[model samples]
Structure formats: structure tokens, C-alpha cells
Target: MDKIDKQILAILQEDASTPVAEIAEKVNLSSTPCWRRIQKLEEDGVILRRVALLDADKLNVGVTVFVSIKTNQHNANWYSQFSNTVKLIPEVVEFYRMSGNIDYLLRVVVPNIAAYDAVYQKLTQSNALFDVNASFAMEQIKHTTALPLDYAGLN
Candidate 1:
């Protein structure tokens, strides 16, 4: 909420495992206040979860593809069915409903193009996918899991 809180958040974003004493030192606060602030931030739902980021390549998930999907029907029942089915698919890491030509966009991770093709076929064959188009990510120029910090003015 204040400058210190913001600074703490920034440091935690970089590394959630950062020690309380280190954070306090960085933010010019004592250990107890810093720990309390972190606890309060969690209770307030400002800090969601602390997780370790993994290397996709090392995990045998080297390829990332974005899939644009359009459904035959836009009804509530249809959406419910579609969302439920998509959520169960392991290859689909991210799915988004958008205000564009496509009804949904999905970010899929796989080991190879063949694996992606198989997943794609399985997904479309089982779902009400009217249209599907995929674009592979050639290079990840700037990929950050962190949210933008300029949301102070946002409502």
C-alpha cells in the first residue's frame, strides 16, 4: 500500500524465497515488521502463492504453441461443456476467452510438433471446435510470469 510495501512486493516478485531479514534490510524495516507485512499481504490476498519456476526445456516441454479456437455455438451450455473439457487436457496450459475473431485462445506446451499434432487432433475430435488455427512460438523475446507493476492507477 505504501512505498515500502511496494518495494517489498517488487523484491518478492523477483524471488519469493528471499529471507525476511533480507527483505526488511532492503526495505529499511526490521525483521518482525517485514514478516508481519508479508503475512498481512497474504491475508489481504495481495500475495497469492510462492512457487518455484521450472525450465520447460529441461522438463521435455520445449515447444510452445498458441491455438485459436472458434466454437459452433456461443450458448451458456456449450461454453460450460467446452470449458470443462478443455480444463482437463494436460497439454493446454493456458486458455482465454477473447473479444476477437476467435472465441478462445489456448497456449499449449509439448515436446515436439508431432506431440502437438496428436493433442490437437484429440482436442478437436472430442470437442465442438468449429475452427482451429495454431501458431508456434519461434522465439520468446520477453516472457515474464510476473504481473505488471503499473496497476496502481487501475481500478
Candidate 2:
């Protein structure tokens, strides 16, 4: 990708709904070229699916919980089963395999403590975990889906 592609990405990351003409104007290109660039970005997988950001408080799922999981079973079959079980829980919005003492981490969102407990119960019932720890966030200081484009080394 070139500088124009990076500029397009930076703009789209802020608001995918921005008009092609506006993007072209900002990037000093014609509308057709800007539109084609966006299409190319999509076809090349540089630009994934666009989505609307939702307000958790308004949705009644304000509470955020980070769960750290350490498992005794590290085999492929065990991981497959664990991943499948985790995927079934709607509250688990993010899941990651960590490099530190924690084997896996999950970010869960719920309405309240009781709702979180229900999700916790579901997670444990499906698979056996060696150790599970959960930490609740009192406040969300910053949350964003936008990625930094400077890291791409575009001029």
C-alpha cells in the first residue's frame, strides 16, 4: 500500500460512512480513484468489514470484566474444546492467548455482577479450567476501535 492508501485507511478508520467525494477531496484525488482505492483495500483484506460502535451503558451491558485462565490441559484437543466452549458464551467479547503466567484471557461484558456470574457459571460448566481469575473494571478511561496508521510507515 502507498501513502494514498494509508491516508484512505486513516480516514475510513475514523468513519467508514465518509463520502467518496469527501475522501477524494481530502486526499487530493478524484472520486473514482478514491472509490477504487477503497475497493482495492477491501479486496486485499486491508480493510475488513465496517461496523458501528455501540454504547455499552445505553445497551445495559456496562460492566467490563477481564478473565485470566490457566489450564492444565495444553493439548490441541483440549484447546479446541475450550475455544469452542468460549465461543458459545455471548458475554465473552474478546479472547486471547497470552505469553505471561496467564494462559488465556477473556474480556467479558455484562449488565451486572449477577449477569457476569451467570456467564462465569456457563464457562466453567462447559470446560474444566485449572485456574480462573476475574477482574472488574470500575471505569473505562479510553476505548477505541481505530488503529494507528503511522505504524504502517506511510509518508
Candidate 3:
């Protein structure tokens, strides 16, 4: 992607609802070419999908918890089963496999401590986890979905 494409992606990351004409004007491009670039980006899988950002507080799910999981089983079948189980739980928004003391990490959102406990119980019941640790987030200082574009060498 060129500089203009990077600019387009930056703008879209901030607000996907921005009109194509407005983005085109800001990026110093006519409407047609800007629109074409956006289409190409989507086709190339650069622009995955647009989504509405919801307020967690307003939704009554402000509490955020980070869960660390360690398991003795590292087989592919066990991993697939664990992943499928986690996917079924709506409270688990993000899950990652890391290299360290913890085998997996999960970001869970819930209404309160009770709800989080319920999720924890559900998870433990679904799969065998050797160790599980949870930490509550006291404050969310900064949160964003925007990816850094400088790494793309478009700056």
C-alpha cells in the first residue's frame, strides 16, 4: 500500500462510517479512485470488516478480567476442543496462546464479579485446565482497535 492507501486505512480505522467522498477529499483524491482503493483493500483482506463500537458501561458489561490458563495437554485435539469451548462463551472476547508460564490468555467482559465467577465455573467444567488465574482491571486508561500503520512502511 502507498501513502494514500495508508491514510485511507488510518481514517477508516478511526471511523469506518466516514463517507467515501469525505475521505477522498481528505486524502487529496477524487471520489472514484478513493472508492476503488477501498474496494481493493477489502478484496485483498486488508480491510476485514466494519463494526460498531459499543460502550461497555452502557451495555452493563463494564468489568474486564484477564484470565491466564495453563494446561498439561498440548495436543492438537485438546487445543481444538479448548478453542471451540472458549468460542461458545460470549464473555470471552479475546483469547491468545502465549509462550511462557501461561499457555493461554483470555480477555473476559462481564457485568460483575458474580458473572465472572460463573464464566470461570463454566470454563473449568468444559475443559481440564491445570491452572487458571484471573485479574480484574481496575481502570481502562486506553483502549483502541486501530493498528499502527508506520510498521507498514507507508509513513
Give me the overall lDDT of model 1: 0.89
Pick the lDDT winner.
Answer: 3
Given candidate 3, what's the lDDT at residue 30?
98
* lDDT for each residue of candidate 2 in 19-94, tens digit (9 for 90 to 100): 9999999999999999999999999888889988889899999999999999888899989999998998999999
Per-model TM against the reference: 0.94, 0.95, 0.97
Alpha-carbon deviation at 22 in model 2, angstroms: 1.0
Expressed as tens digits, the lDDT of each residue in 1-155 for candidate 3 is 88999999999999999999999999999999999999999999999999999999999999999999999999999899999999999999999999989999999999999999999999899888999999999999999999999877545
Q: Candidate order by TM-score, highest to lowest?
A: 3, 2, 1
Candidate 1 lDDT tens digits, 38-96: 99989999999999988999999979999999887889988888888889889899999
Computed on alpha carbons, the lDDT of every model, listed in order, comes to: 0.89, 0.93, 0.96
Worst 10 residues of 1 by lDDT: 145-154
Report backbone clashes per prediction. Answer: 0, 0, 0
Q: Considering only N, C-alpha and C atoms within 3 Å, which residue pairs clash in candidate 1?
A: none
